[model samples]
Target: MIDCLTGKILKKTPDTVVISCGGIGFAVQVPAATGGSLPAPGREATLYTVMNVTENDVSLYGFATEDQRACFKMLTAVTGVGPKAGLAILSVMTPEKVALAASSGDHKAFTKASGVGPKLAQRITLELKDKVGKGLASGTGFASGADVPAPAGAPAQAVAALVSLGYNTSDAAQAVARIDEDLPVQEIIKIALRSLSRT
Candidate 1:
């Protein structure tokens, strides 16, 4: 039920952060992306958090944004995906990329995460696709371009081109998917970059 915590950072690490709030320190597990964005120790910061409880243990997971925390919740909702696995996936892919990949049925993109095998990746995609698709189609959840269906042929090439430029695979794919598939790769990339830069 703890929605967020805003306090001074007592410690920060790649996988966890200790924040002191109201004279108490709470250790929160976070993905690498969130960890990297955190202020240094002794600096003030805020984290959106989710608390997971089991018969034997209770744990806290944190993210830089509500989008990320929401994604984590969605990820852990899938069968066979634990909070640690969710963290592992988020460590490599941003929440936006994960949502795009899920909605696009790009299972392979998730396989890049540690501990996510092809089978699990496929399950994650299949289950999440519908959920995320509903959210996107309803215009209630993700930001723009999240559920874009990658166009056939040339648009795929444009997505690949953007991936080479250091953009997340699903993100690039969704961006290219929003444009005309007949456009040349350069134009697609240019348009996608412009769209992405605005975010």
Candidate 2:
């Protein structure tokens, strides 16, 4: 599976790098983050890699760390998100931010990636809400600390309040997940409504 490679860098471009290992040079597509982290040409570096194969082409993608590779794999699993788009997202946002956006249902944050529109952004967050953390590279946190982990399940009253405000049951639940459960129901509703309004 070519899980990883360590070698001297032979060439590099904006999103691609060629590393020479055992006299063979391998070309790999990389996210901007990985690209920026890579050492200069002639310098040795190690990359965690994934090989993608299809009907007519074989491609290799590399990351500076296994966590970023894991993040790449998870992002590509979403419907309508191909490797290029997945790389595009990682190019702009760190894995932690992506995980935070998914956990908090902040679809707008994903739209900052090139070629990611509102619908795709929403689908990415909605579909990954429960699944993202498993593969997320740990240690990535929002600098603002707004991506606080949520307690499982949503408070019924909070869900109801958001629903009454025109949010779907699922979205309301997702938004309410960001609030502290210890707070009063009214407070939960108020905070959830405010968070949803931002999305």
Candidate 3:
């Protein structure tokens, strides 16, 4: 229930920080990036937090933003992803990138984090592909583009082509979302590739 914490930083390690609030110091496990984002030991910072309680242990995990916190929760919800693995993913990619990877079927991105193997990475993508954008991202194009849904003929073909070329579906859709839907799939793919390269 520790939704957030605001206080002076008492100590910090690679993936943990101790925050002092009202003279009480709280040890919080955080993504390494979150620990690095904080100021030195005396300055104040705030962490959006989630506390997990189990039969044997209770732990507090903190995130740099509500988006990261939400992303962490979403990632942890996957069948084999524990809090540490969730933190590992966030430590490597931001919430936005996580959404992008999930939607794209780019499971390799998930594997960059320690303890997340090929199977787990693929599982993460499969499980979250349709769900990450619901709460974890906004305007991330996980909705890819709000004005349009995944297209029918040429556009759908373009998306498929992009996916075959190693681009993820969400990214491919976003890249082609604003282009003319009536164009040939090849033309759409070319335009999308051009546009995506600039990003």
lDDT of each: 0.78, 0.75, 0.77
lDDT tens readout by residue for model 3, 53-141: 99999999998877778778878988999999999999998765676567667899889998999999999988877664332223232
Error of 3 at 52 (Å): 0.5
Estimated TM-score for each candidate? 0.72, 0.69, 0.73
Q: How many residue pairs clash in each candidate?
A: 0, 0, 2
> For candidate 3, which ten residues in a row score worst on lDDT?
133-142
Candidate 3: which stretches are off by over 4 Å?
Answer: 133-199
lDDT of 2 by residue, 1-199 (tens): 8989999999988799999999999999999889999999999999989899999999999999776787778788789999999899989976655665786588998999999999999999978775543322222221122222222222545555565667765566566656676688788888887887888
Error of 3 at 33 (Å): 0.9
User: How displaced is residue 147 in candidate 3, in Å?
Assistant: 23
C-alpha RMSD by candidate, in order: 8.7, 9.1, 8.6
Error of 3 at 100 (Å): 0.5
lDDT of 1 at 48: 93
- The residue pairs found clashing in candidate 2 are none
Candidate numbers, best lDDT first, in rank order: 1, 3, 2
Q: What is the overall TM-score of model 2 with all chains considered together?
A: 0.69
